[model samples]
Target: MSPRNTRPTTPRSGTRQSPRVALTPRAAELVRRLRAEHGPLMFHQSGGCCDGSSPMCYPYGEFRTGASDVLLAELGVDGVAEPVGFWMSADQFERWCHTHLTVDVVPGRGSGFSLEAPEGVRFLVRSRLLTDDETRRLGPGGPSHGDASADTSAHSRSGGPGRA
Candidate 1:
């Protein structure tokens, strides 16, 4: 099967934790292709002014993340054993604390710095507010609620949302 043919691994009952972000069939395929070329990759939603406010894909470690950033989710790429991380600035997270984000792609140009620009497509975040049950799970601050780190078998190496 073409790498693109792979589907997002369906989350199974009693088997996996809810993902912070997910990919559509199309986005997953693109990621598979990009990973083959770029090596491991990660996503950072531009915090606003400085980074152009577009979700960008980068070779892990190519872009710098720090304490000011919040780890939103660690995504499982369809054909890759390693998970891709998704992050937002701490400030940006404040506005989106109640929403679930999905990393999707469309045909167009995104931030010039994002690795996919040359491919003529860009990644976008599709969001929805968390349900009451999900909010309860969150408790307050941090991932999957307070515990930003989880051993959900979804990350590239460290099974967590990757701290900046």
Candidate 2:
């Protein structure tokens, strides 16, 4: 009998896997363009209402985040030198922390506050719960950074909010 072949898919020693958030090819192209026109960029995931759970992109420092917000992951897009910050409401993150996020672009109108709205496309988030291995690799930190006093609410929530 022939011996069975086996190999592990895990990263080799000293190698590190990227965060849970990723950008689709089209999303990456749009992010590059937005970064060129707008400078630094950040993404916040909406829980519901307004944009309906879509990930909104804004120029860095435009939308303020607070302790009620959580930094899910930092996405490194192809050709973009700076990693994009991905945040969520602390309440929302509680529900989504175990899922992997993939930013994607689709045709149609999005929130005007998002940098991509005027480009005839909208940024969306495709998500799925993380696998056991991913959960282990990520370890256990839900929230990354947020100031205690800043308002976590944004335009995607009820009554609409500010852009910059």
Candidate 3:
């Protein structure tokens, strides 16, 4: 089967918590390729600035993240040595915390500064309303809310979106 047709692993039901973010199969494949060329990678969702709301890919640490950003998830892609951190602006997170986000890729030029722009594809976010269980798990404040350094160990090893 084509890799893109394969489904990402969903979280097992019951007590296991859901992940706040995930990557589509196509996105994972792109990440694997990018990692080979760039060494390591990280993603930050733009908060309607120069890049609008698209997810921006950068070489690890290329983008500065601080108190203004929220570390939403660490996506583990097959064949990649390290998980890719997914971050969002604290202000945007406040508006989006109630939803589950997925990273996907499409053919087009993105922000010139983002690593993916050179590859003729850009990363985008796909989101859905968090289920009751997921909302409760993340709580009203959402995972890691205002603190980028908050522990995200639970999401660090997850292969993809945590769906029952």
Q: Residue by residue across 1-164, what tens digits does model 3's lDDT show?
A: 00111122444221111357777777888888898998678788898968779988887766666667777776677678666777788789889977888788999999998887888899988889978876655544443432344322232235322111
**Candidate that scores best on lDDT:** 2
Clashing pairs in 2: 155-161
Q: Candidate 2 at 34: error in angstroms?
A: 0.4
* lDDT of candidate 1 over 21-85, digit per residue (tens): 56776778888899899877877788678555678898765656655666666667556657666
Between candidates 1 and 2, the lDDT winner: 2
What candidate 3 gets wrong by more than 4 Å, as runs, is: 1-18, 145-164
* lDDT by residue for model 2 (1-164), tens: 00011111223221111446777777878988998898768788888998899999988667788767776655555556555667788888778877877788999999998999999999998889988877777765554656554333232233323333
lDDT rank order = 2, 3, 1
What is the clash count of model 3? 0
Q: What TM-score fits each model? A: 0.74, 0.77, 0.75
TM-score for candidate 2: 0.77
lDDT score of residue 45 within candidate 1: 83
RMSD of each: 7.7, 11.0, 8.9
Which has the better TM-score: candidate 1, or candidate 3?
A: 3
- Highest TM-score: give the candidate number: 2
